[model samples]
Target: MADQQTLQKMRQLVDQLNEYNYHYYALDNPQVPDGEYDRLYDELTALEAATGTWLPDSPTRRVGTEPVSAFESHQHLAPLWSLDKVKTEEELINWETRLHRQLGDLANDSLEYMLEYKYDGLTINLTYENGLLVQAATRGNGETGEAILAQVKTIGAVPLSIPYQGTLEVQGEGVMRLSIFEAYNKTAQEPLKNPRNGAAGALRNLNPQVTASRRLDLFCYQVGYCSDREFESHEAMLAFLRENRFPVSPHLRKAAGIEAVAREIRQMEAGIPQLDVLVDGVVVKLNRYDLRQEAGFTMKFPRWAVAFKFEAMEVTTRLEDVVWQVGRTGKLTPAAELTPVEVGGVTVRRATLNNFDDIQRKGLQKDCLVWLRRSNDVIPEIMGVADEPDAACSPIEKPHHCPACGSEVVEKGAHLFCPNTLACKPQLVAGLAHYAGRDAMDIDGFSEKTAALLFDALDLRSIHQLYRLKLEALLPLEGFQQKKAENLMQAIEASKHRSLSRFLYALGIPNVGKRTAGDLADHYGSLERVMAATTEELVALPEIGAIVAESITTFFGEERVREAIDALLQSGVTPESAEESPPHEATAFTGKTVVVTGKLSTFTRQEIKETLAALGARVTDSVSVKTDILLYGEDAGSKLTKAQKLIESGKRSDLLLMDEAAFRRLLSE
Candidate 1:
């Protein structure tokens, strides 16, 4: 237990730290000496580690675990399809060549491309019902997603309602400004590690009140499903979304060819930092909708549009040392402490080595020169060791035991885990922190520091003890203001009404991510039913493989887990059941394989895919002899020719071509 003196000292540290952060990040002014700041931070880290009690807003909790299980599948009213990727000028030229080959003499004398910044953030689909903002969901599995309407409503820049009367599907990236992240950090609160995380966390908040305060913003880029109005080109679509009061990125540009598109990408990369939001790459799309249809689409991405990822920022640095850090998942990852070097645009000092296998594969060692790169503002990663190294350099070795708990570590594939999951303090504390994270249960005000403090200071074990906390008892503890204490309790209380899918996700069951959680909820209806299911029963469900089924069953079988569920129930955490669906029935297209290629004049690619799925057809991106139908849209390409060949060979009678009118009728039936 923390003594009174230690608690008091911690409070002072928090206040002082917050002030320093506010100055450095928010105001770009330093109040305290860097040495002094480091000293205080180190002291706090040590104290928290020693005493096991942490303040809620400590900085150490930023890099969270929960390797995004599967993204919840969301059936976008408009499909959130990916733009194809291109690496070199040759590929871009080849695309242009293909366009000319298909169009022949009719190929427009001049084709234009629309280039825009590809904001590196979560993709969200916003639905406006009768001019009123009604729903927002992530592009999960391109099919379904968690409803994050409450959190999305908090973003001041996102209009609560648009002026349009017709149903509209607006697709955009939810973004956070670097300036805001810095400002938030300067307030002595934890600084967001990156804009993507900041935006994701803000948009997933259970409390719109908290999300509203974060100043998150959006830039709508596409019109998914539109009831009325026609756009002739990609440029027109951008103008439409903007005219409809959707915030569009200002860096949008029109280019004539691959050269112009490449130049635009370069310009954007050079000037991205000056923009309000972070951008990872550039998106280039065929301007004319007719051209887009002609170009058609691959299985996963559109043929007419492509996302050109900027070259990863890389630099050569010395691998000074390697260290092991235990995460909330009890997975021990290796981190390299490097001699400071500049990569891309940022100074780099550290990089993640992944695990033991990665270390061995990379042949990393002390004093060895290594190339490091950062992809999408994530942690810098060691690319490879330099060809030449000092002869005196020593190789880095992996540890056999856990650093925190001294438990024997075992390698599971490429990852190393502490088998002593129940007893490891770091794992326990990390798990609790993840459970209360914004994307999970989103127990606001329950920061990592606070969770640590509660765990160490109060002997709190499971998430259940959190509910037993009284404001009066908390007030006496370090850094607990009466208002803050009350707010924390209220947040916890509010989380009881959290969605059943989110609750299951927050449980952090192995192999069961957000997408799997939604599927389980849809299948079983409630948590109780899921818990009651056996491994065999779970495996019988769609997409639940034996590995995932075993993990789910094992998680439920644990006594500690059972006790945690009981505690949550006692705290009045009621899980709402998922709405029931009609019984499964046979469909006309059942057991048939359908491939959609090129652009359909009748519907967007997403709509066609979803319609086919509804009709019980397995819609594939590629064409083969097994394919029963190849839905030919305008400007059908090589895939269309392939389908014709199959027809000529008398191999298939199911090859069908439907124009806009015919396809609409098919869907209506």
Candidate 2:
């Protein structure tokens, strides 16, 4: 048993250390030297080790450890409301106008508003009970979220305890400050694309240790739930948070009217680029709690608040050159090489130009300054010609010959394609890589670089030639050790018996992706049936259109393609028949159209798709108005965005958004 003196010492140390941490992390003001702080921390650690006892708000609990197997669903104490968005000042004014109209007689009363930066990061809800941090969760579908307690604990800015000593839930944005983001990217093997992604990816990462490494910061904005006390206004709640040392944003400003709020938003927009964190917009909220209640809410957004969203960041850069690259399908696409410029903190050197026609339509010329725009962490795109081109600047011309193989380029509709598929080196390499991808043949350790090496070293011109490779031939290639060569050979051998759907997808039929290939495999059940199907027969299927059917028929009719398929079969590539469906009870998902987005810890994309299919769901590659369900996971991107928009717009009223845990529950049912 520990003595009273030792326990008192431990308590004192914890309090002192926590104070130091609050100053350093939350307030950016260090109260003591690093050595002194470490000394106290070590003393506290030793005490805890000796006693086998820990305080509820002990500083030692801050270090992230023990990753959760899966995030359990957490029901929020209060519904986390999403703010309505406005792009223009007029729209912002209209939002206020609507709020006033909703309040009825209260419209005569001057409405006070609070304006703050709309942080561009993942939303987090932190819960505390009896002055100790109890839970942390994502915003998710609002009513419920993925519990991320372990991950949120890693953030130093989040207080472990509050003075109120009551059950409470506070809302915040988990952000990786620009300074930390820059420092991390300097040494990261795969540098983070942007700060927002860095924070989102880290928070959603399954491993708590990975989340700790990113050094995330949180800024508490609203008192989401409070059991013991009620604040009269938003300002009073913010004051209570500040009193408890919560990392609240210092930029929160009070505005008298809609016009004042608009002025504040303009000022905030001007300083957005200079801020330490990414702010996509400024949020304007009604300050009075009663006023907010009177204003009420729409189905998707709170009527009391509106986010004034900024436009996508655009910058001008010289279009140094336009390069045409051959894809896996032998289509030549134009990509612009620009003089590197920073757009929204990410350096942009390359931007998509779509095609030769896009360059002409945009009036782009070599050595011309062009407008580049990037938003929502998407790939930067050349928007238009920013300025007049130099007098001597050359107009981008359509190439008559393929850049890779010097074969004649053919124009089909709006795109250029190389007819010489066999001789084109780029096409062969890309096709080989695609054939060996995880979704295709499930070949491990196969990369585009390896494909290029094989194409150059082994004089390999076709996919079938890979099967003809010998150990002797592979051993002589650059970077090929005996173990690597053996592994590659084994992997190649194992790929022979892959599912017929995989084999069909690996064949790289134009316009036929993995989903289409799976559909074909499921419908035909045999390779011969698929190969022999007429365009009319193919198009009869609900998913298959005339164009897709024509493409499939045209591909199978090619003598060269038929010969290649035969060669692969002769080389011991015997694709397994499609799996027969077993007798099972009908599921709720039966006949439903489902879409999945983002990285899942429980299953790969193909695995999830297959699971959905087995449960009688029709899984699609994209979100649409017809999409019945969207199962989203960590770092969910544009599809999730689009699905949310559709839901908010009431265009897809039946569309349901669920997390992995919800999907698992449905599976058990």
How does each model score on TM-score?
0.52, 0.51
Question: lDDT for model 1, on a 0 to 1 scale?
Answer: 0.72
TM-score of model 2 vs. true structure: 0.51
The per-model lDDT (C-alpha) reads 0.72, 0.80
Cα distance off (Å), candidate 2, residue 448: 0.9
Candidate 2 local lDDT, 1-669, one digit each (tens): 568888888889988887876554333334444335656877887888888887777766542122233566788899887666677889887877788789999865568988888887788999877665767888765777777876888799988667777889999999988888876643342346567667877887765656777899999899989998988899999999999889999788888987888888888777765678877788888888988888887655788888887875777889999898887778887878999998878888897656777788789999998877775455566667766777967889899999988999999888898988888998888888889988789788788899999888888888889888899999988899999999999999899899999999899887676668988998888899999999988986646777789999999999999999999999999888855768456887887888876657787655888999888888765576778999998767567898999999999877899999899987777
lDDT of 1 by residue, 609-653 (tens): 787777777676556666777777656656788888888888765
Candidate 1: how many backbone clashes? 20
Residue 527, candidate 2: alpha-carbon lDDT: 90
* Per-residue error (Å), model 1, residue 25: 38
Query: Can you tell me which runs of candidate 1 are displaced by over 4 Å?
Result: 1-249, 253-270, 274-312, 578-669
